[model samples]
Target: MSFNNGGYLETDDALRMLDLLSQASGSDFYMSLESKGKKVAGEIQTLFSDNMEVLEIGGYSYVAEVASAPGSGKGVARGLPLAVVRDCDAATASIASLLYSQDSDLIVNILVFKAGGDNADRQPFFEIELTGGRVSQHAILTGGMPKRPCEIIVFSYRAVEIKSAPQLVSGIRGAVRSAKLVNN
Candidate 1:
């Protein structure tokens, strides 16, 4: 699902997501789009594109437009696409979650998104992936735990809240595992 608004990668309502993902270093931000509609879950695979010099954001993939030709997608225009995971594997998501959920004071942008393709009757499950927006290093929380597509929330990290961060992430992992087990 793509929006028509040009240039603005983030909507006004994206403050929560921005703080949660872009400025995620110390805050728990909840995402609630202003209007009626379903929010699209971003996948890591789409964030980090392959070494093709081409960039992919959302469902759109673009590269540098020729200098002589008309304006297609360049500098800021490219960045207009929301920052999200461009590419990822199983371990990627695990490591991302751990990294984002880590106990720290310095804030960083950590994008944890799921692949929006789970069917209702097929045991709802989501695949978490790391979207390296502004953050550099990342870790894994529930490396071996399973994730439920329907039960995932994006939040920010706070200074004092860093204490129970590990346990909190563990709980999320446990819950994901439990859901997987129940589904099976």
Candidate 2:
């Protein structure tokens, strides 16, 4: 698909993309968007099906701006910052792998978000000491939060010329955090 920088996808197209990712990876897909004191699931499917506006980031990531209002439905809302749905798995892994293969200064941040409490209450939970590139042995836990844990990993490489490593990491982190789940 010819994805514009900020183009929005219809629900059917989004669902199709999710289906393709699931088939390719052999796993079901889910977007975590909290609402009404709980994580909303099928609402994402419903919103997409209804052609709600979703922001496309870097072709692989998408963010749906959900309204915080209770009865507010249909098209995208104007002012309120409602909820966010992100494709927090396969696409992230692909990005990390691609960055890892390219350069040595590449730093990959794996952000694990568990269910239960709000995003704010969940602060810098813990960090793992990695001596090498592989993270296969680590079991990331978040103080027994929700059963449905979602991970959003971002990769950044230090610039050889102008930008510093911290700058690059910060920019990448901001971008990744802003991105909501659409498809893998």
lDDT of 1 by residue, 67-152 (tens): 33366554221121222322233334543554465532322222222333312212112221212222223212221122211112
Q: TM-score for model 1?
A: 0.16
Error of 1 at 184 (Å): 44
Stretches > 4 Å off in candidate 1: 1-43, 47-102, 105-148, 154-184
Alpha carbon deviation, residue 118, candidate 1 (Å):
23
Candidate 2 least-lDDT 10 residues: 158-167
Candidate 2 lDDT over 1-184, as tens digits, reads: 2123564333333333332222223112232222123322222222222232222211123223444567756644222111122344334443334334543332222222222322232321211111112211111122222223223222112211111121121122111222222211
